[model samples]
Target: MFSRFVAWAKRNLPTRESMEANRWLRPVAHRVLEPSLWRFTRRSVPRGVALGMVTGILCPVAQVPLSAIFALPVRANIPVAALTTFITNPFTTPPLWVAAYWIGSRILHFGEGMGVEADAARGWMEWLFSEAGPSLVVGLTLITLVFAVVGYGASALGWRWWIVRKWRARAEARAA
Candidate 1:
């Protein structure tokens, strides 16, 4: 039943060329990312996921750059690093940002009166820009750093366990 669904999904999916450049870009991505993935995979899935997630969140622009790091050991690294998307994907991004803001506010006492809303942070920032420029910058910087560290550490631990367990299973299968 699942196989039939998979086959149907594959058949209905758009052609490779019809997809966006990023879709078919994995080959190049693999070339660049394999090394990093390989090195990180040596640690474990949780570690790799943590590294990837932190990298992705801290500097979204660096996703490709970080992926290149993982691409080195294509087999182990890709899967582990790809797990980073658990934290970095589109759906989770906004929530993460909000959380970062809340954390920042708690630590800095800047947003106490503002309450938490999707746009509230932005409004707070805008107000800060006009009213407290240095404080805003400092707050944002601190928030970004905190989230990055937390994301990396948590993901790494979780991914490490996952990767190790998976590898062990594979090893047992091969031995069998």
Candidate 2:
């Protein structure tokens, strides 16, 4: 199942072909698309997911570019890293921010008034800047870190489980 999903994802996702067309990157296109970097191997994909999650939350606006920056150095699956950033898109951001604020308030013990008051008197930006800013930053940072670690671990475990399942199936076939 995991193999199929990875295979499907690879097919659907864009390759470095478009990026390779860039004059600057064209010079290093081959290095950029090194097979190991794109392959759905246990190591590459997990690290790619971790890289993606970290960038997705931390650099919401430039998540893909940030993921690529990390992916190139580590040779993780570039497309997966880029794709995973979608986890924090427009619909999700508000809830995520809210959760982060709540978590930050608990962990850091920011006083009772973390809530945005019914301030028709002040704008949302003013509210965010004055009340929510620091806690949001700390909370988002912590959430991003936790997600990165968890994503990496889940991928690694999935890979192991897939390998074990394949081995069992092969052994059964041999016995038959």
Candidate 3:
């Protein structure tokens, strides 16, 4: 099972020029990542990593689309946007949608305090059309606004920090 998984991962996540680059890059990656791995043992690093993962997993609608936006400004650190993709992992997607629906309901002041079930949220648009056609517009608008605010803010901060660090490193390297 492990070998199969490794094979699949290698096939899907191939690094181009692996033979040439790995000779040098592998050692450098290991050296750099060693400290990062050790730093992950600290509480703050784990918290930051968790926040990044949650932001990626919980804000799928915003994260995926805005990853492109982050990619534009921080072209050198595309990996940050790529890492943000973890927010929409297979396990967290359903719950995220349900939460979005619940948030939408709250913002619209409809179904007050009623926890949104996945099935109910999935059919919410249809229900709105039948039961409260006018309210559907309000619900959709509220959902968009809430998601945009949360997603944009989190992704912007993450991307901004990533870009700043990269720029700082380049500047320091030039100075050296």
Predicted model with the maximum TM-score: 2
Q: Kindly provide the TM-score of model 2 when superposed on the true structure, using C-alpha atoms.
A: 0.81
Model 2 CA deviation exceeding 4 Å by range:
1-12, 113-127
RMSD vs true structure, all candidates: 8.1, 3.5, 12.7
> Which 10 consecutive positions of candidate 2 have the poorest summed lDDT?
111-120
> How many steric clashes does model 1 contain?
28
Error of 3 at 116 (Å): 15
- Sort the predicted structures by lDDT, highest score first: 2, 1, 3
Q: Which pairs of residues collide in candidate 2?
A: none
Cα lDDT computed for each candidate against the true fold: 0.56, 0.83, 0.48
lDDT of 1 by residue, 21-75 (tens): 5655665653533344345343454455544655666666657446535535533
Residues 16-127, candidate 2: write the lDDT tens digits.
Answer: 6767677877777777767788788888989899989988988868788778878988878887798888789999999999999988877777655544555556777886
lDDT for 30 in candidate 2 is 78
Better of 1 and 3 by lDDT: 1
Give the higher-lDDT candidate: 1 or 2.
Answer: 2
Worst 10 residues of 1 by lDDT: 12-21
* Candidate with best lDDT: 2
